[model samples]
Target: MSKVEDAVAADAATLGAMQINAFDANQPEPLFVEPYAVTGWATFIQRAASSRSGPQARVGVIRDDSGNVIVQGSRHSLTCLLHIARDNDAAADLYGPWQESWGAPPPDMSKDRLDAFFGEMKAQHKAVMGNVPHICTFIFPKSRGGGGWLTAPMTDLEIIMTHSTARGRGYGMALLQWSNEMADGFGLPLYLDAGEDVVGLYTRVGYVRQPDELRTSKSLVPMVRAAVKV
Candidate 1:
């Protein structure tokens, strides 16, 4: 994973809502896909037209538990993003029925609905960083690694969660192990902004916590770790 093998970019496909596409021929092919994340996100938007009570459209789910959180993406293929972007009423027709599901009153649909969604996506970008296409998502029994844009140097851990009912069972560590494996394979480092409670966790797991010198908020602790084994 340390040395780079040069490969030319051969094909690019459309991934829904992602600024970047996946399956870059130049980079290594991903080993698995996050079906839960994709289904979760697509269901959230698709059902938004019918019911707002539906679960969130993010993250790969733990089959044994009820918690899931996607970090930088919801798994919409570029094809999906373009489909919604091209049609004006498509987005509203998607998220409109779920308006009451929102905590506040719905926004004006009289304006561009796609723009409204993009606005929300932009806010998400601030939290997860720009569209990080290359990510390896895994949940216990099933595991798939690879599927990301090859341009970036580091891989984002994104959001890691274990249901309250499932905590303390080493699930979190298992997830970290998966991330480390990918980093080892790519010869890159892993980067994430650790929250207060998890700062100790990152330290114990081998992530070098960055100083708060440039911290925008007192709560966030930035950390990084070399993916390759020393």
Candidate 2:
């Protein structure tokens, strides 16, 4: 039997390796930097697991009968910033002292490219959602300390991936259903930006894709699942 359990900081390295193995092929863009991929993932997982004051961030891993993690997923509420903003010059140089502070690897893309990418993403998010309760897939911390997007309260299924060797099973859907339960409890709509290949899966769980005109890129489609009380 398989069971879903909360992922702790010690699971970071394992989850990082799993992440690299799972998303390495056919990713729209490089999801993690080369040498720093594991480090970056470890940092993110550690922060999410340890930080108590920020939006509620939870990670769940599905373990096989032998206790091997076959799937990992995360959910976070977008109620407020994880940490307060501080002075920063990192925006000008993304991979400098600020990078150390963030303790995570920056995206594989260049600073200019990342800026343009995030800029368009933010624009689309603002235009489509417009101050409504929503969740986001990505957030960057400020240079001086911890920080995150301050948004209207909503639940987000941030990352959900099954191990490459375990893909044919229903682990992914199980994780999605787990997140749906939490979103239902919050009584706010759940939102995410889905990759083209997986949009159908999300749709099956009540995620309605946004208009094509709202897309910032051809590969990503934003979707929302309305809150439903159980």
Candidate 3:
């Protein structure tokens, strides 16, 4: 069985190609333009693997015996001390210095719409998690009279993908289980944005919809899994 390991910069190229194959190539409406996708993902992985500090991001890969990456995943966590702005400038406020890494927007993707989507996501998060230790939560703090603050930090699962040929071998679930185990080690809740088609899968794994969630035109669903005691 393939086991998860830290993805090094050398794995960036394969991860990039796999990203396009898993997310863009098969989609009816491609999220990334084909011409720029590979380099874009490569650059992203390279930078993340290099700094190892930015956003505390980490990438993992499961490789076949032949040493080809068959599945990839990335995750990060926000510490309790960081403060996120809740206003329209939230994204800019939190990520302005790192904007250069954002690169150019694809021609098929609308810059304004994308920005608006992120802006709305921030808004929803702020409403439900004002000054919380993390962006994700297990309960509605406001409804519970906790004044919109989660009890602790949460781990965010940013991306997970398995190569097409590797599907149905339980690779995706293995990666997800690895993520859950990691979060459980830290006793932090797990959060992710799930595509519409995979909502059932996430649900089966203990993730529940966020309160007052924001659904994208693409049917993205926001979910949070409560932390399991180690």
Candidate 4:
């Protein structure tokens, strides 16, 4: 296999090991119990690595010297990162324009209206879907540096739980440490988003909460139609 392919294989092996460890230790439910999880994560890794974009993605798997897999983690470009800004103008713009253009009318709530609403929603969904993989990586990295002088260039992290039996062995920490080493190697600041429950985990590792990010969704049929015609 090519070097890149070898790396990917090694990474996948690490992920499998990590998952198996987590499962055995009863840390939490595994993200994927069936074949879907393994296939899905593999697809994501391949796509990210092949993409021609600014945020180059990479997957790292920990393995034994004999090439046995142990744990896995991934990183993606920062542009895909999503932040729910406290005062997000883009979201407001997307919904506000539509809400103002189409007032509350029965026809506005009719089947056609519903169709348009769904259409707009689909478009927004597509836009966001394109951003999910990369942003997800940024939010789940192993280590994040400080805001100013300590910042590093390679800043995104996403830890992948490939197996359930691999938890409680510090594999997660190892992945984060690996990512941090990459960031430090490149001299950049690391950043990630955490769910409310996992915020403490990140804090313990030097991640602090930024301003609370919010999300708003609204119907955008009229705007989309107008753009399409233009």
Candidate whose TM-score is highest: 2
lDDT (Cα, tens digit) per residue for candidate 3, span 95-163: 332224446776777667557645554454444434333223111111121111121123534456555
Candidate 2 residue spans exceeding 4 A from truth: 26-31, 50-54, 70-109, 116-122, 136-154
Task: By TM-score, rank the candidates, best first.
Answer: 2, 3, 4, 1
TM-score of 1: 0.40
lDDT of 2 by residue, 1-230 (tens): 23457665565666656555555444556545545645655565565567443334456677655555434443211111111111122112212232442353454546665455455544555555554543433212111121211111126444565444555456656666666666676565666656655667778878888888877655456777777766
Q: What is the C-alpha lDDT of each candidate?
A: 0.33, 0.49, 0.48, 0.34
In the range 69-153, model 4's lDDT, one tens digit per residue, is 5333432111111111112232233223323222333431344543564344334433432222211122222222211001111
RMSD of 4: 14.8
Name the best candidate (by lDDT): 2
Model 1 whole-model lDDT (C-alpha atoms): 0.33
**Residue 215 CA displacement from its true place in model 2, Å:** 2.4
Alpha carbon lDDT of residue 79, candidate 3?
Answer: 10
The true-versus-predicted C-alpha distance at residue 155 of model 4, in Å, is 3.0
What C-alpha lDDT, on a 0 to 100 scale, does residue 95 get in candidate 3? 36
Question: Between the candidate structures 3 and 4, which one is better when assessed by TM-score?
Answer: 3
Q: What TM-score, over all chains together, does every model reach?
A: 0.40, 0.66, 0.64, 0.43
